[model samples]
Target: MSLSPILDLAGLTLEVNHLARGVRFYSQVLGLELARHDEAAGVAEFVVNPHQTLTLWQPITRQANDERLAPLRPRGASHLHYAWQVEPSDLEPSKGLLDAHGLEWQEINLGTEDRPDWTLYFFDPFGHGLELRGVDRADARQPHFAPTPVQRPPHALPVMGLREVALAFSDYPTMKERLPRAYGFALAKEQEDRDFAQFTLGPHPEPDGNGTPRRWLYAWDPQVGLADMLGGDHALVRFYADVDAVGALVVAAGLPCLRDDHGLAVRDPEGHVFEFIAG
Candidate 1:
């Protein structure tokens, strides 16, 4: 049964091998602010956005051996990559900034060879693939695809109005009891045989906002056990950007196109993957 109402998704949380390094990389490179840090606990939370948090912590020693770091190993392969969007104009300057920092980057064509929109790609310190894109493309020749909406909820809604997540959990009962209370997420619905459930994104319906509620799914599986639920070691951090901003940031980052068919992928120093998409 549902125990409490839905709360905002505060951000993604990840336990890293090196806390200090992660903090430095995110702050200096990505421009995330350090919301808070507990020196005694060695836990820090970076506010990626109003709704998103990048959490970092480290144990006395990491359990994963050198063998676990094998590039193509399946033991802990992350199937998904996150996409971060930037403004179109910001692409150039962003690439410049990245190049100054000694990071490699590239440009991308979103549509088919005959018709394509240029995009940018780079990696974070954790090997997470990140993309910066524009809200709309200028090339009339490029295939026309509708733009994804900007995902910001009203402030008046419930605890920050965070709605979407793809968490991996094991027990349904424990999650039913705990998640809603902690994250301000409500039980929009659930799917039993599919091994997952869903929560509404954004705040509860309010009088002024026109946006409809969106539902996000969370898949529970043995691979994503309870202990490994919150920080599954495999996560994608999404960044939002408009068309002009996408170009500015891309150029500043000095990145390159990933491939012809897909967005670019790069490795951060720690090896986590992030993919970028338009907001």
Candidate 2:
């Protein structure tokens, strides 16, 4: 029997070194509105939209007090790479915003034949890499998935919200079957590469109406991950939807469960760890 999709992507978490510096980069530099911060817990949360949230937690070793936050390990910063969506018209302003702040950014195309999207890449103070994306995909690929409504504060900042999260896996064939079966993430698009294919899940129209839909992408590359340069195949994701059912599915699948402090932390069949937090 196929399991229902448990996570609605309520939020994504990031591990940073310094709390103050990390806050500065995300809040001041990137312009993400500061939603809440618990200094006692050494965590600062940002509002991505009214629904999906982003969090930065300073590992206990990095912050004061030994008993800090749950799922806390001295794992350094998040090497997990992901992209954020911005308005197509705000693309120039986004670039200008980065340039104005003296933050170095690089641009590249992440689109199909007709739809060419220009994405800007930059790193936060904690070395967590991020992208500001905009696209004009005249020929929309795959079935159209409507974006969930998120009444966020405003698009006043270059950083908008999280979408695609790239993780590493060794077996695509096995994962391709088990992932959707376990999580209900549809196989949206598959772009072939030299070694492995880029498989996207739960892809939809850009939340802001541009760029390739948020990539829930996974590629089989064991070489580079989040440990080095924050390019790891691991990610901690939150489930705003069916939390209990998802956790049960992880056990039923016989995949490894690493930690479950604040949520159900489990590895895929390929051994990529993701924290399934219930928001």
TM-score of each: 0.42, 0.71
Superposing every Cα of model 2 onto the true structure, what RMSD results?
A: 5.5
Instruction: Show where candidate 2 strays beyond 4 Å.
Output: 1-7, 62-77, 112-114, 135-156, 170-178, 195-215, 223-230, 256-279
> Clashing pairs in model 2?
79-230, 164-215, 225-231, 225-232, 226-231, 226-232
lDDT of each: 0.42, 0.56
Q: Give the TM-score comparing model 1 with the true structure, all chains together.
A: 0.42
For residues 1-279, what per-residue lDDT tens digits would candidate 1 score against the true structure? 532222223344454556688787766766666887665455677765444556564443333321222231112223222334344555667677777668887776655676555656665555444455453333322111212233232211011122334544456566554434433344556654655655543234221111222323353443532212232334433322232333334334443313112232322222333233333
How close to the true structure is residue 167 of candidate 1, measured as C-alpha lDDT? 44
Q: How much does candidate 2 score in TM-score?
A: 0.71
C-alpha root-mean-square deviation, candidate 1: 17.5
Give the CA lDDT, 0 to 100, for residue 174 in model 2: 74
Model 1 alpha-carbon drift over 4 Å, by segment: 1-10, 60-80, 113-115, 136-279
